[model samples]
Target: MKQFREEWDLDSIYVVDSALYSSDNFQQLRQLRWITLVTASLKVVNILVESLGEETFEDIEVPGYRIASCCSDYGGVRQRWLVVESESGRAQ
Candidate 1:
């Protein structure tokens, strides 16, 4: 990300899978002012479920993020997508 900003003079938005979702990675990205759109892991979904307890996604609020979209497979598994942006990006 630093290279992209300094060398290429580009602002990059990352779309990463659950495998890359970690507290350390999130902190690094936040520190660097990079935005990421990621697939929410089952662990994250579970935490939301536990916290909300029967409430819908619309009621959830993540300090630096907005729920961009969600999809579910009622027949089988469920998946969620979350878009995380910086406070600066939220203004634009």
Candidate 2:
């Protein structure tokens, strides 16, 4: 990320997967103005379930999908996270 910022002189948000969920990476990115859309890992999902329970999720309407979100902290930075479910995803 530092390299991307320094070399390209660009500051853009990235929608990332669980691979970028490390605290070190987030801490670095947070310093920049890079917004991250990280898919929640099982550990994060479990913590949210344990801390806030299911009551906190609010329904969100997206074009063709049923979505829901909850606000929580990730790597000490507060942000909203979304969860999408499908039978095939569960089978994995």
Candidate 3:
């Protein structure tokens, strides 16, 4: 959740302890919990953000303008990159 931490100033994501859920719908519920948590955190932090397929960004970040997507994906706080995706540019 580095993006949230750095850009949005959010702390770690909530622990969804899927194992604790013994219901048949545990998987679905766990996934939903993640979505709800991230969405709520964004709103609560007052970041001008949007949730597309994945990866939240500043409201002004475009689709292909070379984004430094330090998407600290939390489950919500796991980040997959120390840098961003770019062929010849820096992380946005």
Candidate 4:
């Protein structure tokens, strides 16, 4: 986790998101409905792979991408999106 914090900056390590309460288009959003959640790369993709048995996936779907950008200024793990290398057979 220390490695991630240093590499992703304090914002990515500590994220927050704002939600406007009571908008005409998003009436579902309300001050009373506000909540907070926690998300970390190690807690997400890493954990998912772990649940699937990392030993079995070593030859399968390895992490072919890296965290190109993470905007903790947005919300949750919105910053930890997958990135495809230019030479890789995938979309950017």
Best candidate (score: lDDT): 2
Give one digit per residue, the lDDT tens place, for model 1 in 1-92.
45544665435555555455556555434534333333435565545434542223342366654333445332243444443334566465
Against the reference, the lDDT scores of all candidates come to: 0.45, 0.60, 0.35, 0.31
Q: After superposition, how far is residue 22 of candidate 3 from its true place, in Å?
A: 18
- Model 3 spans > 4 angstroms off: 1-64, 81-92
In candidate 1, position 70 carries an lDDT of 46
Could you tell me which 10 consecutive residues in candidate 1 have the lowest summed lDDT? 51-60
Among all windows of 10 consecutive residues in model 2, the one with the lowest summed lDDT is: 57-66
How large an RMSD does model 4 have?
15.1
**Candidate 2 lDDT score relative to the true structure:** 0.60
TM-score ranking, best first: 2, 1, 3, 4
In order of appearance, the predictions have TM-scores of 0.36, 0.57, 0.18, 0.16
Write down the RMSD of all candidates, one decimal each: 12.7, 4.0, 14.5, 15.1
- lDDT tens per residue, model 3, 1-92: 33433454334444544343333434333323232222323342233223232353332355544332445433343433222223334233
Off by over 4 Å in 2: 32-41, 49-65, 87-92
**lDDT tens per residue, model 2, 1-92:** 77866776555666565577777787766755544555455577767645653454444564333345777676788676665544454356
User: Order of candidates by lDDT, top first?
Assistant: 2, 1, 3, 4
Task: Give residue 32's error in model 4 in angstroms.
Answer: 36
Worst 10 residues of 3 by lDDT: 44-53
